[model samples]
Target: MLTISDLDYRIEARPLFDGASAQIASGWKVGLVGRNGTGKSTLLRLIREEVENPTAQSAIRLSQGAKLGWVAQEVAPTDETILEVVLAADTERHALIQESETATDPDRIAEIHMRLVDIDAWSAEARAAEVLMGLGFKHADLARKTKEFSGGWRMRAAIAGVLFSQPDLLLLDEPTNYLDLEGAAWLEGYLKKYPHTVIIVSHDRELLNRCVTHTMALEHLKLTLCAGGYDAWLRLRAERVAQLESQRAKQDAEKAHLQAFVDRFRAKASKARQAQSRVKMLEKMQDISIPLAERTVPFTFPSGEEKLSPPMLVLEDAVLGYGEGADILRKVDLRLDPDDRIAIIGTNGQGKTTLVKSIAERLPLMAGTRKVPKAIRIGYFSQDQMDELTMGETVLDHVRRALPSDTKVAQQRAVAAAMGFSHEKVDTKIEKLSGGEKVRLLLGLMAMEKPNILILDEPTSHLDIDSREALIYALNDFKGAVLLITHDVFLAEATADQLWLVKDGAAKPYAGDLADYRKLVLQADREKPDPATKPKTAAVETKPVAKVDKAEQRRLASEKRKAASPLKRKAEDAEKRLTKATAALKKVDESLAQPDQSSDQMQALMVKRGELTATIEQAEMDWLEASEAYETAINA
Candidate 1:
């Protein structure tokens, strides 16, 4: 629970929040959304500062005893195992356990044990493992040292630690930026069931819509909180904008009529009094001030004049990888026509990139035939293409260098403008540009080739929701075939008509849609066995435990279970209902996302979805209550 009242904040005299106020209820999952460079992250920093050093004049306030948690940065590479790092995140538990070893007083030892039971410390490792697995870590990887993982995996470990800590007020900024589709989807479900208040700043539309209970719009130097998801917020904002426009129009007409009357009658003595009255009425009228609509720059992917023949690119039973005898993907049979729009889907490290690279001719097949017409052109955009850009060079410099030597200055500027870079932006150095700007620049360079097929890998990673929508529009409008690899499900759903699954050393057509694929991913996570449940191999041989010690351990365990049985049963039942309700709601949401449904069917599904949403809300409340009661009973 947090309250921000009349918050006024600025950066170098530029206002980020002016008279902004919001109340976040306990247990509410709030999705903070706004365009890029809109100070969303700054707001989070302010909240963190307020929580850390409370001042009487500060605008942000949290409930007493509420702990705030966030992943400030990626975990530094260390010798600690992933599991140990996550387990140590719960400082209270770790300190208590450490103190228990040296605690000589009986009262203090008893107090530690009671507190551990209250916190459900017995299941801490299991919960940590679940979070790690959902975030794309293998069971074996839990024991691996953090120094052995890459920077991205290290960031995920940081995220897992924060999640496992379960702070009362959790703050997540762009949490899904490093996640693959599978990890993102798993995070969505996990957050839906999180027990405490959450304030997440993200550009991920699917995660916002499916996970958060409330949408917090940060725009025009103000904050507006709305019930429901991003779609609901959009609908409400649209209606408000229309209403304001209508009111303004009516006010303008009234003012015009009053002005005409006053002008005509002010010249006549007989109507002079009426003219004065009309003038006063006009002066008293308040102007309806509507906020200016945010402008989004469009992405252009122009199609070439030449038409390519069918099967413009083909890979027949190809073994694709970095080199000979090092095949990452094999038995791949794929074909791309000039008009195809395909999306590649799979878990991370499943050779999705390898498949795309092979298709784009960037990687040669080791043992299979590849066919392509010499006239066909392919433009490839790698996910890490930004790294290839020279930071010291300007956008115009890159554009000019990428274009033909004969291209005129005007034509170069025109190409840069088409990629959403204005004259000022074109001259700006690459190091000064934002991630989205760099992505736009890369796209501009790619589009200059006038290719028949585009192979784009994770192109939307740095784009905001509006920019992503603009890209979806451009991709659909472009005449060239598109082969996209992205973690953004909304982009995939909007642009791709066919799904290609790259898994298990092969690339093939997937029979289901994006919704079905999401379900499959979530189901896999649910079915995964918790690593904590696995038996550990002993490093050294040990004698069996004494019979008396074993009997005492069993007696204590049985007593603990007996004391919590009733409340535990209630919690289990509530959990079951919540799971069922959530599944039903997901089904309706999936149906609502379909593009080809009839109007009547869509209306029916909308109603069903509304009902299911309410049911889920109530079920969530019941589960929370029951779970708390169970914990209290055990602690007692």
Candidate 2:
């Protein structure tokens, strides 16, 4: 158990936390969330006492003899075999084996028995192997040198090592980063049953909701601790935003009233003193500045010609795998349309990546009809995008290379601007681009190709919030068909119109939202509910049990039908408001592009732009609220 009291942390004179206090008690699993530079990692390190000179006013006190295990963001694999690394977790096993080999007395046998019983060694080695295999290490791979693995695979190995430690407290930072969908889901299930304390920093909302019993949000120089997961946090944050809006309106009204009084009594003899007093008081009063909320990225795709029908891509009776091997994905029958925004999901090493690769044409499909429609130009973004960039080329140069025809340098600059590259950033070398920047560059190049179809594999994995939203918006507006492979459930739920359940080395289509799919995937997580956090499902047994099941079912069905009508109306209303705001932003874009815009007209347009920006922001907030209400109603 860890107790953080009035904690304050700083990095290079930047205050990461101020008076932030939270308790991580026994049997607690917390999801620590914040922006990239907000110091979630630093906070974790401070709590583990890995950082020195922590604030005097703050304290992170852990129970005595607490064994801590951490998976740091930057993972380095030593020159040991994977098996050797995993076997290292079982120190008792090694010691016992040593003593068994060299024992000179029968009493030593007693000592060995005691030690084996103490550490539960009879089953621990097998369990460790099970865990490693579950995490996607082949039996052969267990003997491979760790240094030979790629960065992502090495990170996975580090994760396995940490999990094997089975410490009292676990700290995992972006544990899902290197994992495929299947690997991520496996981890989700593992964390669900883990009995000890866990504090995870992750960007995967689905993973957070699956494993975390509590949410800790770092914002505004403080921490907000709450029960439940991201959904609960979103709801609470929305309510707080609403409260701030109300306060802002009240403050504005009071300011207007004070100004009106001041204007009326500025020159009047009797009212002058009262007016001056009011003015002085108002100036001294803390100016109630409205809270500056996060700004959503404004984005819409350009229009293109629509196909006569949904751009269909069909895979028939497919047996896909590498040469002379069993099909990694076998006997697959699938149809994809423009309307089907499918998310390929499964556990790690279960062939999600292989399926994506086969679809993207990066890998050959051994025995199948891979049908792609004519005029379907596919823009495939994958992990290989990082490898495709030339070592010496600038970011701008790489993007320009994607252009089909040789274009003037100025035209390439225009293309870069459309993709959010500034002049200074344009000159930056491809080797120097950050992960997020590389993603942007790849997207910009894809946009230039004017693809009628897009295949994205783990596209959102490296993107920050702003970039993710922008990419989502682009995908939403795209007239072309899309086939996506991602572990981000929120992204899928928000953007996908349909779902694909990838399991048992194949893909199957499902007609449902991501929430439905999530319920299915998480159903396998059968951890016992914490008694401290469990809520009573219904009123206690104060009334006799009713046994009229048929009548009760019919009554409930009738009530559900009755409830649907009004809920539909609310959904329609929200959709209409969102439509109107989207149209207005489009109009602003059109107005700004006018060729003959005069100086005075431009000034007016700027004022109008600000107003429209604020209106769109409010509309988005309202839309989120409305959509949530509609979803809740439907589920209820």
Candidate 3:
């Protein structure tokens, strides 16, 4: 359990948090949220006491015997092996092993060994390895030195260490920034079963919704703790704001009535005493102010001057990957119409982004050709593309520079306004901007380009909820084709019209939605073979299916039709009878449900309804049997 009371933090003179108070229940998964720079991270730091300011009463109080674990944001180079660092997080086990190794006395050694056994130190290595694997690290990478990995991969190692530690309180910040959707989903599942208090600071809404039990928002220089997940927090926050506005309105109306009474009789003698009383009441009333609603970027992609004909893009038997690299996506044939909105989804490192790049013609195909018009214009939104923006520059300067030199100041102002920047914010430096703001500025610039097709890769990684909603609205109404690669399941489900599954060196259409795919993935995981009892086999190579000649195919088709004709007829007949029986039962039940019906008539109807229901049940069973027979006949 953690309790915060009268928490305050300041920088020099400016106050970040003042008189903020919150109570976090034990074993709760909390998601901390607020606009950028509203001290969400500061609160986390205060809870962990990482900040320099120190005071007893303002400090976070944790119950006795509770352990806390936090993923360090800056995971520097170290001499320790990656796996060793994770395993070392089990301090008791590590210390016991060390003491046991050095102890010459049999009694002391035996005591230390017993402690190790009680702590389950024997399987620590395997558990750490498993966590590293889930976070996209290979078994081979486990023995490697921590300094060998890039910063992003090291951040993943930090997260893996925390998970392996299994502390009473676990803190994570933007845990999904280094994880793909598959890895993030795996982490989500792991945390759901974790019997510990977890507090996460992340922009990944899907992660928040999946793992968090409560939300702690730092807003208006105060803390608002709410029950439920991110969406619930949003609902409660809006309600709170609405309630404030309602009270403000009531206060305004009352003041107006009081002032009117005071004004009408201020100069008259007839109601002098009442006027004085009303004036005094008005003077004593405190002013109530309503906060402005949160404003999000309202920009949409510019419509192309004219719609292109169908087949805006086509890739024939395309092989996709980097230069001279073995194809990760092979023999892919895809066609995109002007109206196509395809979302590419797959596990991490399965080449979803590679497939997207191939479609955008940004990557060269090893074989086959991309058939596209020379005049085709693409507006691509990759997270990496944001790096091209000049740092230390203002958002307005970037947008204006992207436009024509001849574009008027009025038009530029309109563009900035559409990008959620007002006159004052237009000059805010890019270096000082939040992740969401920078991404919004980049997107606003892209939308101003008026391209014929938009290809986005992980577009929602840095966006807040309001900005994500705005992007979804824009994408849904976009005139040209859209090809998106995103980990955001909600955005994919809300915007994409079709889904492309990239796996096993191939890309193809998925005949289901995100929900269906998730179920299949979970079922597959549940059905995975246990390593202890799994049989080992050599990898088998598979050849492409052979094609048959026209005459042979015709003959086979004729045989299949002849075999299936009778069974198909039977199934069709059963289906018709089932429909009729169901309708008859429905009518009888409706007659029996009428409130004004006589008891004798109702009794007769009930008996008839029961008989019809039995008939309908039989028809359903017959239909199922006939359908199975038809399937067997067709296969045979």
TM-score of each: 0.81, 0.68, 0.76
Can you rank all candidates by TM-score, best first?
1, 3, 2
lDDT of 3 at 12: 58
Top candidate when judged by lDDT against the true structure: 1
Off by over 4 Å in 3: 12-14, 55-59, 74-81, 105-111, 138-150, 260-275, 390-397, 408-417, 421-433, 525-636
Question: What clash pairs does model 2 have?
Answer: 182-346, 182-347, 182-348, 183-348
Question: Candidate 3 overall Cα lDDT vs. reference?
Answer: 0.78
Off by over 4 Å in 2: 3-21, 46-64, 73-84, 90-122, 133-154, 258-280, 296-335, 364-374, 403-414, 465-473, 494-636
Candidate 1 minimal-lDDT segment of 10 residues: 49-58
Error of 3 at 375 (Å): 3.0
Question: Model 3 compared with the native: what TM-score?
Answer: 0.76
Q: Which candidate would rank higher by TM-score, 1 or 2?
A: 1
lDDT of 3 by residue, 1-636 (tens): 998888777865878877888888888989988766677777777777776577623557887889988886535455588988888877878788888778999999888888877877887877777788777776567777775565568888889988998999998877876787667877888888888898888777777888888988877777888888889998987887799889989999999998999889989998999999998898899877665666665658986787678788888898898866457888999888897888887876789878877776678788988888777888877666434566556777897898899999888888898888888888876655677777778788888888888988888777766677888899988888888888777788888989888888989888998778777665553222214222234369998987869898889878987888887787678667756876787688678656588756865675676567567556656765666777776676
Clashes of each: 0, 4, 0
